[model samples]
Target: MTDKAHVVIVGGGLAGLLLGCVVATTCRDRLSVTLIERALPEAPEESLDTRATAISRGSKALLDHWMLWEAVSNEAKPIEDIHVSRAARFGSAMLRDAQDAREPMGWVVENVLLQQVLVARCEAEGVALLEGREVVDFCATQENPKLTLNNEEVIDADLVVIADGAQSALRESIGIGAIRHSPSQFAIAVNCETDGADCGVAYERFTSEGPLALLPIPNGSSSRARYNVIWCAHKVKQAALLKLSDDDFIGALQAEFGWRAGKILRVGRRTGWPLGKIAARELVRARCVLFGNAAHTLHPVAGQGFNLSLRDVERLATVIATEAGQDAPFSSVERLSVFTDMSRKDHEQTMGATSQLAEMLDSPSPFVDGLASLALSTLDLTGPIKRNVAEFGMGRR
Candidate 1:
């Protein structure tokens, strides 16, 4: 190995790629990064990812700092307004971009597009990309951390970052316990074509069953308006809905979402996944650390999962930049402790708020429903409350 401190990142998904890019650019002279991904990066002509993430303004700024916003701007659809309402209830609220300056509250981009952009940025920044490689085992020591790939190849690094995702085998192998909670819900995702014009509007409609979100997406050169749908429902209902025909699924969605976005014209390939929350007990151990979903997996009600993860990456990069030196670097206990201390408040707040919202909104209790309605009404009438909520969603807080 070279004299530079080597950092090995497991997983090449959004979090891993973003972390790699940020570290490679921010600490180029101090560290060398190698990203090991299990699968090869998708080709440009491959199908667009069905899943979408709401990129808050804070995350956008972070991407801009990395000089990646320009490459993804054209493909991202800005959210100018967000409408929140409950089914057959008087409580409703609308969040407008004007309330938070003229800038977009957030932008929506497919996972594939984000991955492509980050991959390109990583390549340009000289972050070594190892495709089709998996870290099956790892050992963290005071001097050098080691990762054993499936092919029996052992790679040594000064620090190891796990971004392998929610079901991280490496994290489990290292005996890092996670607090898991299942709200007995699942999320169905698909791309939707609507009859309305592209006005950069998004919707979050809460039903008796769960919360459904419709996020705006770029219509490209076509005249049709498109939105990404994330419908959270009970596991049983989700299973039944997933089996429905395309037309039937659209009808079901229209019933829950109403005609706010106009009639749902068509629905693309539908997919569903179990929804749950997982937070690792400890974020850092010796020379190893957890990032992104490996640190926490949240419900999608607030669309804050990826946004929060990006913030973690941002703070972590800052800590590494400040603590790293020729003598003391990423693997030292001092660096890990500082990182943990700095991140605790943000992590607790984001996780607590997200978990509470998911549970309260999805509860079947009539009292909770009344409280939810009252809360929305309060948010609608109170400017301070609304602004605070909006800023929180934008990852400003």
Candidate 2:
């Protein structure tokens, strides 16, 4: 077995790339790092899968650390306000105005743009990226961890991080157990153009169909640039919804969602994905660890899916980098413990928030709607509680 590098990452997605960027910059001369991805890297192009993320102050801080924030800041729109409402309720709850915390709750960014920034940084940091290569097998022992690539190359390193994604074959190969639950629903995502001034706000409306989220995108001149939408509905309803023409779809959306953004215009093609959750029974061992979706997959109720994974990537990179800096036992059990402890609180909190919201929103009964209204109203009334909730959801405090 070859034993030259200290760390090997098994995925090239956002989480893997972010971890690589952080580790590459911090441990450049000390540790050797390599990243393996199954697909070739490509530039961002026009696609119907117009997914976007509400990056919290915390996420922005992490990105700023590597100096990539400025590069992609132009593609983001700060969410100065958030309007949340229940379809059954007469009035909506507002989490805006000053004193809504110290900053504009969070910034919304396109997924394609974010990916482009991360990929560029990874390349700039001199990370050894092996594209079109796959991890066919991985075996971790007490002394060393080894990975076999599809290119017939084998690598033995002090630590191996599996970031292959939610359906991670690495997780399965390692004999790790995870709980998978289907929420009996699916999310249809699309991008729509609006004819109004961009208010720098986000809207989330809960209906019997599911939760529909509208996030602002950066369009310099007017709000007409476009907004990203994720409409969750039952599997049976998805087909009919997707069959509507763009104009008819906008009319349907307007009926459900009022003129919050003035006039809604063109909509890109929509893509549907099943809603589910996956949480590994355990996330760490002696010399191997799981980060990103490999560890947990939450319902995308609050757009915390990728940001939560970024937090994991950051924490794991810090733990591993600090361990690499020390002279004592490398990849020791204690090092793994550090990762476990650091991520325990945040992971539990995020999982609890998203899972609870999913369950609460899934029930379309009047009672549930009343409960939802009361909860939001209470959150708006209580400053500390609301701030904490916002911080947890925005990946900041």
Off by over 4 Å in 2: 1-4, 40-49, 97-103, 141-143, 220-223, 326-330, 377-385
Count clashing residue pairs per candidate: 0, 0
- Residues 1-397, model 2: lDDT tens digits: 2333478888888788889888888887777778888884453355434567788778888888878789888778889877887665654666663463566878988766777787777788777888889988787753787788887898877878888989999888878899999757788888888777778888888877678888887654442657888888888777778889888888888887888777887787787888778888888876778888888887777788778877787788788777876775355776677888988888888898877776676765778777777887787688777666666666763
For each candidate, what is the lDDT? 0.84, 0.78
Worst 10 residues of 1 by lDDT: 40-49
- Per-candidate Cα RMSD to the true structure, in Å, reads 1.9, 2.7
For candidate 2, give the lDDT: 0.78
Q: Alpha-carbon error at 272 in model 1, in Å? A: 1.3
Which is the leading candidate under TM-score? 1
Runs off by more than 4 Å, candidate 1: 40-49
TM-score of each: 0.95, 0.90
